[model samples]
Target: MGNFATLQPGGRPLVRFYLAFMLWFVGRAIQAAALVDPNVRKEFNDLPDDFSFSLGAAFNGPQMAIGKDSNGKVKYLGKNSNIVPQVKITIKSMEALFLLFTFRESTPVANSRERMTVEGNLSHACACVRILDIVQVYLLPKPIAKLAIKRYPKWSLKKHTINRLLINLRAIIGF
Candidate 1:
């Protein structure tokens, strides 16, 4: 009988690490955007005061959580902890997460491609997606951000520049 071999199953550690970092930044950026942008603030405010969310790769992968704090301000809750978020957005696998973090696919695109899934209230998930789109616009450069979102906003110079800078600063400083 001829001999046959099977390849080993595997995981992408580097991709997982990258995803963890990106998720951390994105969580912080969302919180910061709510503080710096009136539109973002309004969107967040519309959510239930206790609203929280988690985004990450599926099956015990690196994840980040964000939600409103006691003062009703948005806060990055760090990695998943005791708090159970109202919405959880999970990417199907490490490859899909890599694609997402690398900007190879936008959130909407990934959803349409069936590479991602959401659990919880549909309306809240829609709001979270909108928040993410706006945060991505601030966090990434114009050309790349354009690729990351469905429709780019027509922002005034002050908003695109000043608010972007403030959001980046706040997110980085853990404000």
Candidate 2:
């Protein structure tokens, strides 16, 4: 329906499309959570204004943009472009990335296993992992989240319901 990674008759584009989709999927989940979850949003708020981060893989591999919008909200900067991010997180391979998203692996575990690498401040990297962990709780259901994260928050029913509703709305509305 759109050039939003519309399929092309090539293997490379196909892989790129898949990676882009995954990045968008995961990014939205994290961004939406950051908007509604005070702790997660606070992490971004504490960063320098316009702090930028990029995630990608090896040579000529798919890359995704993530940055603070003018309002200091964490948002996806979309497909890879010229924006130079202060931090870059690169995975060893698509398979490794897939494992992380699929909940077969966690970020710290992946780092220890040498599946991913980061070039930037260690504290920022840790913060990113924390945000991603919260995203996992919202994005993946209980069964998967339990497997992916070392600790899942035990939210009260009332708080959980309202947070879920707001997170989904903000995600769709692109706040």
Clashes of each: 0, 0
What TM-score would each prediction reach against the true structure? Answer: 0.94, 0.82
**Which candidate leads in TM-score?**
1
At residue 78, candidate 2 shows an lDDT of: 70
> What overall lDDT goes with each candidate model?
0.88, 0.76
Candidate 1 residues lying further than 4 Å off, grouped into runs, are: 1-7
Clashing pairs for model 2 are none
- The worst-scoring run of ten residues by lDDT in candidate 1 lies at 1-10
Model number with the top lDDT: 1
Q: Candidate 1: global Cα-lDDT?
A: 0.88
Q: Report the lDDT tens digits of candidate 2 across residue range 1-175.
A: 3656855543466666777777777677677887678888898987778887877776656777678877887877776657888778899987777677667887778888998888888788777778777877776678988878888899778546787777767666766
